[model samples]
Target: MTDAIRVTGLTKRFGARTVVDAVDLRVPEGRIMGFLGPNGSGKTTTIRMLCGLLTVDGGEGTVLGLDIRTAAAAIKRQAGYMTQRFSLYEDMTVGENLDFAARVQSVPGRRARVAEALDRMGLGGRRDQLAGHLSGGWKQRLALAATILHKPRLLLLDEPTAGVDPQARREFWDRIHGFAAEGMTVLVSTHYMDEAERCHAIAYIAYGKLLAAGSVAEVTAAAGLAAADVSGGDPELVRRIKALPSVETATAMGAQVHVAGADAAALAADLDRLAAEGLSWRPAPANLEDVFIHLMARRPDPAEAAR
Candidate 1:
């Protein structure tokens, strides 16, 4: 089957810095692929390149089965891209903004489309409100409505839920899942691990490189991480474990400390040594956040390593 988005050897550079290195990805149709990374890690750059917003300095790819390099305009028309910032006119009313967007896209039955967009996002009652006065949640709803107004085959969301309230974020994700259930493909970039877990699959990019890509369980297991949850009397047992050569990360949570390492046996030995200290320890499943932190810390810096 033809993939919804496929790219090979993708690379982008800005002057002296290579923001996105050669990367390969394949996202099937009707699936939500989560793109995750830290700040300035080229997540946005990669998204732009795939969606035909920015030209790739090198590499070849197809989005929605159209040539990314040569048929950018064509591909762009079939994709919905929600930028990091709200882009609609603040002076316009909610209804006015949707109407204008429909007109610009040349969507058939402009008024009907605008009304549907407003209604679909549960903004029909607030249609008369000025775009500028809406809170972050309402603005996010408006952005999402505008993005889907064009009925594109794929949706690319760049930090779509940032700064929104928890309730609003939940509602937004529910709508996203509804879209995916209807066979609409989505590629969302987010910093929240909880949101990342909601995706069908995830790709972690750091410093322009693809660090890990797989299901939540697969990614964590592939990281070769073993975590032991410790609780009880002495908390200093965790501190002692931290000094072991095998422990890669030791983090506290409430009354428990999670000691993780790539070598399970060595980590177990370290914890065993602390068994007599009245500290209780049990092996725990490695969470996505733990694996993400481990990958980030283990990533080698070429400049520093060269020395």
Candidate 2:
């Protein structure tokens, strides 16, 4: 498959600090690549560089077949970026906001395009509503409408559903899937594990380094964590399990506890203790959240290491 975005040794530093290390990434055309990482792990910086909003301190690659180093402006023209925060003129009406975006992007047939975008995003009925007066869900719709006002080839969504209600979030994802079906390459950053699972592929980063990539199954398999679901709701039991030297994580989920660790033999011994205490737990498969937690715990903070 042809790649819509491919880059190698992508690095960015702020003064003496390296925010993004020598990272290599490939996003295939017409695919949804979920960018998963903790805050301050260079996800935003990397996205900015890809779309030409920020200069690349180091890297060489292409976005939509244009040279990233020299064709930044050209790249920006065809790429739509939606920031984490709602960024639109609150004082302006929904229709007015979209019209301004079309004008700024120099979109052709501005009137028709803006009208089409408004309808597509289900904002046609609310076109005259002041942006600031809209609820969180409506605001999200408006932002998305503006992002696609110019019909960009690549969509970069950075935590787009952070504060959206569950129903609105689902509808937004439906639209995203529709765009991907029409062959638009999408690279979205999200903290929600369920959203990440919806993506065609995943790229996980921590401490400025990529720790995992590939499908959900592949990443969880590579993590190689031994996990179990122990049945118990007692807080004291959970606390004791957490204090176990070999147990990496013991989280209470409703009436049960999900536990995991890297060392099989040692962790099994801890489980045996819980079994003797009349708690029942069976071996379970490791999941995406478990893998990410394991990854973060294993990676030391660079700032802490420097000191």
Best lDDT goes to which candidate? 2
Residue-wise lDDT of candidate 1 within 114-222, one digit each (tens)?
8888989999999999999999999999999999998888999999999999999999999999998887899999999899999989999988888999888789889
lDDT by residue (tens digit), candidate 2, 1-307: 8899999888898998888887788999999999999999999988988998888889788999988889998998999999888899999999999999999999999999999999898898999999999998999899988998888889999899998999999999999999999999999999999999999999999878888999888999999999988896477778888998877888888888888999888888888887887888888988889899999999988888879
Error of 2 at 60 (Å): 1.4
**TM-score, structure 1 vs. true:** 0.94
Error of 2 at 201 (Å): 0.6
Best by TM-score: 2
TM-score for all models, in order of appearance: 0.94, 0.97
User: Once superposed on the true structure, which residue ranges of model 2 sit more than 4 Å away at CA?
Assistant: none
